[model samples]
Target: MTVRSTAPKDTLGEELVRFDGVVKRFRTSLGRRQTALDGFSMTIPRGSVVGLLGPNGSGKTTALKALLGLVRADAGTIRAFGRQLPEGQALVASRMGALIEGPAFTASLSGERNLRLLGELHGVGAETVAEALELVGLTQAARRPYSGYSLGMKQRLGVAGALLAAPELLVLDEPMNGLDPEAVRDMRALFTRLRDERGMTIVVSSHILAEVELVCDRVTIVRHGTVIRDGPVGELLDRGTVHTVVRVEDVTAARSVLERAGLAVTAAVGPQGPELHVGATAADPGPALLKVLAEHGLYPQELRLRQASLEDVYINAIREADAARGATGAAGDVG
Candidate 1:
């Protein structure tokens, strides 16, 4: 479906949302205080898909809640559309929509009816509701009772509700939680269409790093309630280590040669036969690797370069963050 919006284009690609040094804490049942967010900060560019990614208990959801004004921050500042939050939430309420955790619906009500009810509350028109349903690929199943809808179908309906108001900024937490492969593909396309066709900015928080890598223009990874990595997907990926896969007959010999040459090597079986993966510490270790392999009479049948995946970068970032935290804690104990 062609989704078009005539909303003001003056601020397209500009900073639409900003979270600065935000801090949030909660009191657990045991009377211990938990830091949900500590100096968390991020910015969402207008008309772009930004991925808010982190492991469990990484303050992703808490940051979203604080932005929506569902919870207040003890410190730091948030601004949406250049208006300070909490004070200006009402003014920008009509421009933002969010689906946090999972959405709830009346069991007996049909999906169409549920969305219609939401439209009524938001002063949205019936045609808009229909458009939303079609945009989310739920038109055929729109009449299905909410109780009978599959998990993926329910997620689609929740997304349709978020789109009902034609919001400018959409925040979705774990939107792909229960979607099947096909549904995930459709949702990714929907996000692209929303950004390209409708010119809407999106903030998606999910643990699916691969999906985030495919759909997000920029990624912000948080740990211990603070951002440890934040940049455009391309820039971040390029900053990671380069990998070269060498297909050779003598895999064991090739591994020895590469490792002795100061390269990290691993073995794996590929489509043809055994292959050696060389993690190049230096940039462009291709020529040097080939020379060394030829020197040892272990010529490569085929050699190819591979870029680091988002998952690889994410793992390294988390490990580094954890190691830093561990060292800090040790120093504190020493003190």
Candidate 2:
């Protein structure tokens, strides 16, 4: 593992990384001003996994790039290791590793050889390389040529390289891209092990909400370069915010009844059959839904209350952002 830099340590309870009111702007080819990051702010705590989530172009990459000094923010404050960014970037980066987009590996080199070549540049020794390989469980195949390795194996090697520094913080953007289901599951477990065993703080950027929910301690959803939602998975979808799915004999009639009652209704497919998602209200929404459907001469073949998934929370956040944008755009035209 690489030696930790002597950068000033963070005070207790202070986040490992913090961005406050960060802004970044770009100009389109046609000379129009395009804001990629606008008032974007987020924090990553020590010994935690934080996911940067949003649809494509929601500024997830821009945020990460700004933190790593790959891109400069036009305004706002950023910190790493309790010190300001860019200035602290050199020292702090010495104690962190990242796999942004796709890692670059020499196709001609073996997995272990590639890591060794890169590690040598960073002063990482053979022992550390072996340990990193073991950590990522790439020891047996380490000698295999990089070109022959499967996508998952290549990814594991990338992680092994990132582990070279035994970094206190690991920043990965869409690390799970192009992996099969099994590989995805394996990678998720690997990231968890890194945090629980190494006390490493991780900041991952991804649009895959379901996996993010499973892997991240907290999630931040961004839209139009602004944070739309940020919280632990359960907190965003609290017990009070559960959804009820109702599959009725008449989909149209049941949907109309639910919507007419002032509750949000969305057509969905439940585990058992076609269903409608009804937002929960009060103590128990299941009973109330049944009562309403009965009043409308509609009965559901199946009715159940389900906890909201991370995808549900993400979708709601984006939808709300879209509505807000629409309203603001309309208001701008009116006056």
Candidate 3:
């Protein structure tokens, strides 16, 4: 298996990881087959931090496991770099680092020693361990026993261990779990540094949508073991409404006029004054909004446009998937 160096012109960078129509199912003790992945397909671009986001049981971890060869898919091809899965995983794994759900180390050992041990597994030397520790802001705490470190420090150490390999790609699952607000902020900065300095690709699966929006260049959202949406974070979120918030002198008149013009409008007391919350099409909703406001002789003292958040896109995707699944189930029952 070889790494792919060139990406499609349309993508941000090289193609690092790809899952095509992958399927995996687990049989319960009662002999019920639970589908963990159903024809899931996603491509991770190189040198970009790509968020792999989904709710629990949405197969986020399962997808990572398959990509890393920690688990085999019942069906589908998993590729790392350019090499296809299982067969290419070893070669690609060498260029990749992973810190899954929890940090695992000999608790009694010092953080530095634990890193050394992990380094040995990858034939990494002491210098590499030191660099990794320094990179993850663990240099000062490296000599402390793993059990004595704070939860945030432990998370940082886990990240340090992953970096010991100086991998071309890093896979982190809920890396900021158990972190304080400051710690989360620091971790986000570190990921940005990794992308900016090392040009490493990252696949992060996290429940924290806000953090993902801050650090990820793009995102692949999964639900019901399949892709609900995949694209640049900005693009996916922009697919939603462009809300134009206006502070007008008259509330009732503005609302009536805007509503008559087919603009969905709501009102609330905002920081400045009474605000008109208007939902418009994905395109620039400003000009059309102004036209309607001017026609009604309503002038806005303040106007602001609020782009939809990634959370909005995520929740809607899940809702749509649920509706589709319910419809499918209903059709099956009828048959």
Clash totals in order = 0, 0, 0
The whole-model lDDT of each prediction reads: 0.87, 0.81, 0.82
Q: Following a full C-alpha superposition, what root-mean-square deviation does model 1 have from the true structure?
A: 3.8
User: Higher-lDDT candidate among 1 and 2?
Assistant: 1
* lDDT of candidate 1 over 132-170, digit per residue (tens): 999888999999899999998998899999887778899
Candidate 2 per-residue lDDT over residues 107-198, each given as its tens digit: 98998999999888778889999888887667899888899988778777887788887788898888887677877887788889877766
Tens-digit lDDT track of model 3 for 231-256: 99888887865688888888899899
Clashing pairs in 1: none
lDDT of 3: 0.82
* TM-score of model 1 vs. true structure: 0.88
The all-Cα superposition gives candidate 2 an RMSD in Å to the true structure of 3.9
Model 3 misplaced stretches (Cα beyond 4 Å): 1-12, 245-278, 281-303, 330-335
After superposition, candidate 2 runs with Cα above 4 Å error: 1-13, 295-297, 330-335
* Candidate 2 lowest-lDDT run of ten: 4-13
Q: lDDT at 150 for candidate 1? A: 91
| Better-scoring candidate (TM-score), 1 or 2 | 2
Provide the RMSD of all predictions against the true structure, rounded to 1 decimal: 3.8, 3.9, 5.3
Question: Which candidate order results from sorting by TM-score in descending order?
Answer: 2, 1, 3
